[model samples]
Target: MYITMEPGSELAWELYAGIDEAGRGPIVGPLIIAGVVISGKCMNKLSTLGVKDSKQLTKAQREKLIDVIYESARYIIIAEIPPHLIDAYNINMLEEDTIAYLVSRIVAVNSHLKLKEISIDAVGSSKQLAQKIREVVPKSVRVVIEEKADRKYVAVSAASIVAKVWRDRRIDALKTIYGNFGSGYPTDPNTRRWIHDMYSLDPYNPPPIIRRTWGTLKTLAPLWYKKKRQTVAGREKTQKTLADFLPKI
Candidate 1:
């Protein structure tokens, strides 16, 4: 009573997919990778909807368009990589693997839509990334990897918006639990203070949310370590001074 369907065949509509990620550089929070597949007509509609690189849009603007994007796209997929995973794996390799997985997942789930091409905002070596993606997707599907493709392609823009919004939400949740960490970037002074404060609290084990392997920890470790030694030395000196002031037994 059921019909068997083969993937990537008997396509009714041709669609283009765009992939993007957020939170790659932040020393905190998970990495978010997103892909959007939309029909040709919907791609135009997305452009008309004022979709651009998520960086250009305000948080309010991105939130407003997120729903419209979901309604307009034929398919969308998002993947999250936690801090521990990122620390354990090479970032470039993790991104490539996630990109390939997202592409394959989209194809498998939306087999009816013939994906004509995929455009991604490249992480590194566009040529190599494109080759890696090409190996996973159908031959007919063109792979376009370029820096700032999010700004040039509406689909990529949509993906960027989705990824950004999701990462922001995750950061907000982390804030509720850990207090404000100031954008979670290593460059933020507040983030640096938070890292130092956390280190002071427990030098051995940091919160699970923090990327322990980050260079920030190493950079801050020595400073705190020195301070710790100085504090102990100061305490010992104070004790000796007190002993000398008191009459010996």
Candidate 2:
């Protein structure tokens, strides 16, 4: 059941929530947004259970904690924006829209839940982004958007774990379909190699999964390299060839 609350000023409830995402920087896989809601009783317990930040935890630990978070979370929800959609839209706008949607959906789905506040790890380190999130949500849900919110808030940390786990599962699925691409970042040599192979095999048409808009593709791919080569060839010709009717003095 979905419930929409009247937009109100900043509110305070005992229940707290944390928001975070994973796959934000990856060149492969969908970006994930996750939020977990916890009341006063479980917030402290979550911290004690070693919930810090997803990046700080091992894969096994994150898997183990997903169950724990589920057991304790009053409401948990995630939204994923796939690579194609990501390419279609502005990333920052997509992030803000997705975050606003996730938080609002959680609160709306559990209309009975009396959440006091939510803290999010800012996407690009801006308070205005937080304010943008808050403005879309029910005004009663006070938002504390800031940098490192996942590290600062146990709830955000738990959410981060869920997000990372979700991203990993998707990455695993993608590997099954497309073979392996290492860590799916530009820094990974294996990833770069896969891209190079793709670019060579299909210079003008790499797989849709590849973010063609990304600089990595345009800079490293053969299409741009071939164009550069042709440009240099033209320049070299212009330099060497003199006019046929040049006057001999």
Top TM-score hit: 1
Which residue window of length 10 is worst by lDDT in model 1?
Answer: 1-10
Error of 2 at 36 (Å): 1.1
lDDT of 1 by residue, 1-249 (tens): 011122232246678889999999988889899988888888888899899999999999999998888777777778777887666555676687677777777677665567788899998557666776776788877788899999998889999999999899989999999888889998999998988888888787777777766777668754332211122422333223222332222
What tens-digit string does per-residue lDDT give for candidate 2 at 1-249? 111222221223467878899987877678888888777778888888988899999999999988888787777777776776566555665677567667766666556667778888888536646766766567787788878889998889988998899889888988888778888888899999888776777787666566545667666784633121122422233332221222221
Whole-model alpha-carbon lDDT for candidate 2: 0.71
What's the CA RMSD of model 2 in angstroms? 14.5
Provide the overall lDDT of each model, using Cα atoms, as 2-decimal numbers.
Answer: 0.77, 0.71
Record all residue pairs in model 1 with backbone atoms less than 3 Å apart, i.e. clashing: none
lDDT of 1 at 203: 83
Model 2: clashing residue pairs?
13-116
Candidate 1 deviant stretches above 4 angstroms: 1-12, 222-249
